[model samples]
Target: MGILTSSKRNRRPSRNSYTVSSRPSSPSGAANGKSFFAHVKTALSWTLGLGLGALLLVGLALGGLHLHRLATTSDFFAIRRIEIRGTTHFNREEVLKAANLQVGVNSLTVNIADVERGLRDNPGVAAVAVKRRLPDAFEIRIRERIPAFWMLKDGVLHYADNRGRTIAPVSVGNFLSLP
Candidate 1:
């Protein structure tokens, strides 16, 4: 009983307390939660700016697509003439037939490498160079293989170049007296 009384006399009891503060707000009266409204206004402005930027990007993309369509399909881009250079073994008709090209085709639709590949498929063609004359023409230069020997195959004679590479089969139109 004496020990209990001594501990109770030395210890102090705890109590609850409240505090008050004076925080400053904007110079313009912000009593009605104006700070919240300002935050909302800034967020809306950012969203609106982002939306406008996206719309501008979409408009530019659409404009580019429209211009590409117009350029590729317009008659103004149609080929008017084709110039074939360096043709020795094949004629103009044969070269065009090999390249599968014709006038009035869209210039933009023509693939230069494809045309060269088509011409190179022929055994007589050793090398090829193709050029596009903008807005309506194409120029192709073909280096033909000159026959270094005459090869006889199954009673028919074919043209052969220096490396024993066979050229086209000899026909009346492309006949050459080669040893």
Candidate 2:
């Protein structure tokens, strides 16, 4: 597009007055009114669209935060049952105490890494996985260290692994004797 401007000069007894005018920058656009209005309309529509998109993005982020807060702190997500798996050495109470889990606690507030770390503190836990089943349950999977031999130290029976490390203490009610 190009601009075409004209000026009109008038002479007076003591002063000169000049007037300036403007037209479309393009020669073809000067005669085409519909195309010019259409371009303006399209630009307006595009600006409105971008503004709406930004509003929706902000709304979604805020809604997600509110929902997350609800999910984490609500009593509806309290723990009701805990399912323990793949444990032949450690019992349910032992595992729960090690993982620091108790019934009626908020399930969503439980941290997987912290639970895994607590479980790993047990000498018998070779590998452990903790998962939350939303709204009321948890799944605990464990891989226990195999005992290579039994050791009696300080009048206590302890199970030792192949690396000569103490795996766990032998319980009276439940005992696995190893030569």
Candidate 3:
């Protein structure tokens, strides 16, 4: 009897003592803890990846701007010749003056839209097209407004187009033949 009692005392405590309460231990508690950590890790990974991608895009944009500046400032793209086309009422010098392009200016640096707008502001120009003929030239095409009739306004003869816009003052030699 004494030996049996000693053997019982020597035996290790049951696994139930690992928990503070008498409630049965569940594997689900450990799994829940692991899953929470996994979720945190996944969120952090996505955040880091998105941040890196944004940085890469900004770097590419800056690089493109730098390259564009270099190409526009290079001498090889200087404007040497300006070809004026589709002009009948306006001379080449008049079109060139409206364009305001300077010889030896960088072709790529010219603002075509501004040039077109300046030409369009002229009373005689109906439309204008400006293009860079790569390497050293610009081609300008002008469409002139035609005078449709002559109007006598304020005791002065004025030439007018189809839109009723006054083009210029008519002289005896200019619009006298047009009844």
Candidate 4:
């Protein structure tokens, strides 16, 4: 009777038929058939958050450096002295006043290139150099425009330099004659 019962149990199920039913399968069957895009959205959010945080940190560092420079340099507010050289036609006071540089003004407030440009704007000045002498000083150096030739155009006196740049025309009596 025991041998007959074991044979009956072994012959119960066939290849095509079983007591348990197979659940219906989906193309995206992982985790109850969710799409792949749902996973990607979560990963991108984390990456973007980290990138924005890093950018903010860099901006703050640059701002701190600029503020420190402003605090340390006295040149940021005033100039203490002015030095002039290589000039004869223009007096020291005339050039300084024209440059709009004031004694005791902030050194940082002045643009040396701009000062040189202002000096050159004077008809008599050929070239100009504006430099910081350190601690509390500015140096203004200039070269005078030399007369190389004289020309009379319709009775107007014009002076030309060696390079043919014409100086301002004035009365013939005051016009410099080149040697």
Candidate 5:
């Protein structure tokens, strides 16, 4: 069915300032009654304003939550344990010392770049990967420095890894036993 239509005598012009007159009183005011486009434009403007405000509020709330998460300490809620693997040139103690990593430090506080720099400082470590094992653990996987060649000086022979750092001393050993 079509829209309900009222008798011409039953409806009165609206008192709203924006509402147009039902009958044109002059030549310039040729248009009569509210134009379909004018009603659509007013409705759209109201909807657009409301929508924009709602979006802005949502954005601000999200930003605040993100800032809070960044500033708060996650370590208090999570525990971290570390395990080292694939190390041969350096002992566990030496590797740990070089890494400068403390057991009690928060995993969230772990800086990847800093850890990498510290681990690389160890002559026996060529490369390292530090990973967070979720709620309670961290894992360090290292590529042990390779024994590239042996150098002899002052009647003593020293073993050098891939980075040419002395790892151990040897007097007389076969070349095959270097690495």
Candidate 6:
């Protein structure tokens, strides 16, 4: 009974004892290769989607331009009527002649800035605004110059504004009642 019992030690495998295989192990290596291919496929799909989206946007812009051209040139948007507002000194026909706007003309094609400049060239007009009343109308708003006083200049009576801008001359008998 005094004899020492012989002991057997259970040994675990060391970290360096694991062998590196040349070929991929069954499931893990296969999954890794599949994931790489899936990533490549997703990247390619995204690239193609972006490219197509850009092309679609360009096509839409071109289509919109064409549609705008058609709409502007068509008779549907032509000027069927010209309406003048705030006109007291000048007649509607005179304003229209200055603006060069005629019925059956394309309203969208009318240059409003040019019309305004032309109208302002007249001495009777103090301010002018040109606008397109969509679909078939052209609207012209004008502000005429007001006479501030009547003066006898060069043996002739003339109506002048505050800025000393001489308006039309009048007869003595016509305005003799005024002070």
TM-score of every prediction relative to native: 0.76, 0.61, 0.60, 0.51, 0.51, 0.63
How close to the true structure is residue 162 of candidate 5, measured as C-alpha lDDT?
65
Clashing pairs in 5: none
lDDT of 3 by residue, 1-179 (tens): 45578778899767764656555555556443466667779889999999999999999999999999999899999999998888766776677777888889998888999889888888777878888889999888888878888888889988788888887788754443454
Best by TM-score: 1
Question: In candidate 2, what are the lDDT values of residues 42-125, reduced to their tens digit?
Answer: 889999999999999999999999999999888999999999999987789999999999999998888989999999998888
**Tens digit per residue, CA lDDT, model 1, 58-142:** 9999999999999999999899999998877688999998998999999999988899899999988989998999999999999
On residues 1-179, what C-alpha lDDT tens digit does candidate 6 reach at each position?
Answer: 47544542345333554765455655645454566677789889999999999999999999999998998899998888888999766777788889888899888888889999989988768888888889999778889887778778899888777888876687643342333
Q: Which ranges in model 5 have alpha carbons more than 4 Å from their true place?
A: 1-72, 75-79, 148-158, 162-179
Provide the lDDT at 175 for model 4.
51
Write one digit per residue (lDDT tens) for candidate 5, span 107-157. Answer: 666676887899887655667998777656778899976777887757788
> Which number leads on lDDT?
1
lDDT, residue 89, candidate 1 = 69
Q: Which stretches of candidate 3 lie over 4 Å from their true place?
A: 1-48, 147-151, 161-165, 170-179
Candidate 3 — what's its lDDT? 0.82
Off by over 4 Å in 4: 1-77, 148-150, 162-164, 171-179
- What overall lDDT, based on C-alpha atoms, would model 2 receive against the true structure? 0.86
The worst-scoring run of ten residues by lDDT in candidate 5 lies at 170-179
Query: Number of backbone collisions per candidate, in order?
Result: 0, 1, 0, 7, 0, 0
In candidate 4, list every pair of residues with a backbone clash.
Answer: 75-108, 77-106, 78-105, 78-106, 78-107, 79-105, 79-106
Superpose all Cα atoms of candidate 4 onto the true structure and report the RMSD in Å to 1 decimal.
12.1
